[model samples]
Target chain A: MSVSTSQALDYLEQLPVQTHRKLYEQPSTVLAIFRCMLPHLAKSIVMGMLYMPTPISSPDLDAWFRPSAAKLKRSSLEILEKLHIVSQKQLDAVKHTAFTLSPGFAKSLRQALEGSGTHRSFGVPAPPTSARKVSVAELDDYARIQWESILFYMVGSTVGFHGGGGMARDIGKGTRSLLEAGDFVGKKFGGGVGITRTGFMFVLQDTNAQVWSLLIEYLKHVNQLGMSETDVLSFLFMLGSLELGQDYSTSTLSPTQLQMLIDLTAFGLVYRTSENASTFYPTRLATTLTSDSGALSATNNPHDHAPAPSGGATQKGFIIVETNYRIYAYTSSLLQIAVLSLFCKLTTRFPNLVSGKLTRASISRAVQTGISADQILSYLDSHAHPQMQKSVPFLPPTVTDQIRLWELEGERLECTDGYMLREFPSDKDYRDMVKYAEDLGVLVWKDDGERKFFVNRIEQMQEALKKQGQRRAR
Target chain B: MVKAVRGTLVKCDASIKAMLVDIDSKNNNDFIIEELDEEHMLVKETKVNALKNRLQQMMKDRLKDPTIDEDSGKE
Candidate 1:
């Protein structure tokens, strides 16, 4: 089956207890899972438990989380249990149940967090040599220039434009072929290959999400070719944890991973000096896979593998859509201007600035191309100037509402895929289960008179059934 | 008869025929000694007072040794 990232994550989540037991034996895997898969508060909880001397009482844990947030706490715990990362035991002659990190996870996490493991999962840095040393700035410039060229290549062909040799040739033929195969581009009805609707959406996403979206697409195709999804995923995680400036030895990687390294290098996700170079360096693009924009922009340390200079935080957002539909952007980047031009009609272009306006016609044209106003608004929101972010609402609420309204006009009735339950044994049983659904935040729609209800997620229902079983046992 | 002092109380005995001023109380400056008992006015150093001083020293010594005081209920 073709496994997307979400599919890969679901596969990881559904691993049998025995598989998790075996996987937790590897410190690298455990550490990688903890860093990437856990939520923000869950990470803090895990860290706190890492060094505790005694099994924490459930009541004590409850006190640790706010009352209103108890549902989140319980869900976090449930996921941890499913992953085999934690265990709860009843104390002798006492009603209290104590929770502790599972021994395997605990030991592995301790090793990973302390950096004491001899496994050397983190790639070894190359020996100091001036000839092959890659500065972070050079790497960032390489990544940005290459990535921008790809966007320009796809977008340029759409507008009957030419980037001459500067942009078109930088991206490899393999990537171009894959883009066409993925339907991100198509053979224009009139003439040359042109951008597709998905192509516009892809171009509009922020760099981080765009990387994820593209990599997910890549992962989906890799499975069809019979590559091991496990090897690809673990290698991607390992790449994320590697130091940005340092080169890593490729000897430890599997053949699939090694091949991936070559393909990734062309995409500017990693760098190597020569085909024979002993080491390879993951670029900032690869390392920032899991970081939010706040971490990306706030940590100004260049050595930390920030994709863009912290100073560029404000410069990235050039477009400001006012309630009156006027748009102003302060950018000279041709790639950004080209993407904006896909949905907006540009009226003026200054030396350091470009001005555009969003009109009903322009928005409707974009909508006709399958690019919703939500995607455009979110794209604008993600790249909003740091100055704009300081305001209470990043975009003018009216503008945001109008964009949603425009998108909503096309989606008069939203469709949801879920399970519906009815005909319970009794009204009391239905009432109790419905109440439980509401508590878990999974109840999408319910009809009391009809005794029918719908839920989008089902994990909580399984637990609720177990509780009912216990009540009957009693 | 003894002669009286000119300003304050006078203490006089018939056999002594001399005057002495009484300054103990301001109520009367002049007075004559009638019958005095010298034996009742004698001063003495007692052993009981020495025992009180010894008791105070013992309490101070006990306070200096905290462990001993803590165990012995000397506080």
Candidate 2:
């Protein structure tokens, strides 16, 4: 799983069980969740159990994995159990444990993999009509224009690059409010909109991650808009599963899904010909939601056949960073340029290329804006020119390290939000709990002398404590 | 050991290369499955069988007539 998928999964795992159960009813949703949300080992386990007559016994499951991978297997199963995708049944007398896939998940995933269900949740393709069919290229153009308009609106206003003459001025009212709602942008004292820290993070991300971030924001606000969250989510998943070139009909969608289509269209996720168009097309942005961000920037957009002037050899990557902190980007896209300007002191611009230098002042300015050096480095790394990709780190080590060093100069203190455990009944108890928390990968800090520790998450630690108590009692 | 798995699978069946590619595409390059031994292949085959059975069960649950057995092995 990539960062975006894990982020989505984190949101999904927080929902109520009823919502998860309802979501599992859709084959497309199940397929999308399985394809992107689960870890590699979890997917393997699910696939291994999909067609079995009997639940996989604990010993059998353990034997399937190498001994060295026992920890990974345990963690994967832990996540699977937590998500209620798989349940464990303990056999009596012999005390053997067996794992079974949740019936709803199994059925839906099976239907999805075999494409056997008539659920139409995968989306119903629009029947061919003579109503001036929109080509995929046109849809791509529409999506790019609408998406860039939103991005430029967020970036241009912050950097004081006014006179966003045409498209940026026409950003939909719904999108503006949504951005405000997500705290990606805020209204200034002078009645003008300004970008927020979250907005900076959003801008630095690749296009696919940016789209997911926006949609996830939209998902958070669905309930207040009188829309069913499950329906909206399943529809979004369906959009992710849809073929990029094909048009899906709106007739089969529920009222909630239909309402979501309007918002999604404004976000440039799905393109519709007009307000009441009968069919909608999923853009590359939408279709790549369930894919890793790395694969997304690497693959060429099939609809994009436009000639690459220079660094546009890759679909979205155009930036080339040298060890000397010199940056060259071959992109005429204003949104890309605006984002680059946030952290790079751009010196000159050609027809399809822009050259810049990463200076200490520029790095510190970006860091002050709440854009971390890591984010800037990752953005540059992901957008590195194909020629630069031939090297191991993609970006030069000196440049990446220097950016971090510059940011580090601005601050000293680091903070983490978590619980600190102290004053245990005994040192042994503290040691045990600390070790357990450490094993769970949640321990942040510990003091052996004080018999105290801190953990990033307490739920798992609480559970371990309870189990330990039970064992002690036994 | 890794090379042995790749050699065995690649030498035994040319079709497995296409199957590996399909898996790779589905995974979105998170990790590539470049090799599989006969033992692992058998394990996967059982999983495939389990999936087929589950699909049949799903057809029974959802379909009125339940005559889609021919499409079960399509994937």
Task: Provide the TM-score for each candidate, comma-separated.
Answer: 0.70, 0.78
Candidate with the greatest lDDT versus the true structure: 2
Report the TM-score for the A-chain of model 1: 0.80
Specify the CAPRI tier of model 1: incorrect
Deviation in Å, model 2, residue A160 alpha carbon:
1.1
Name every residue pair that clashes in candidate 1: A318-A329, A318-A330, B8-B29, B9-B29, B9-B30
Could you tell me which 10 consecutive residues in candidate 1 chain A have the lowest summed lDDT?
A: A1-10
Q: lDDT per residue, candidate 1, A51-157, as tens digits? A: 98788998888888889987788768876877778888987654689899888788888988888868666666666776747887787766666666677878878
* Native-referenced Cα lDDT, model 1: 0.66
Model 2 per-residue lDDT tens digits across residues A288-385? 88877442244455456654322221255678998898999888766677888999989898977889888887888899788999999888887778
Computed on C-alpha atoms, the DockQ of candidate 1 is 0.00
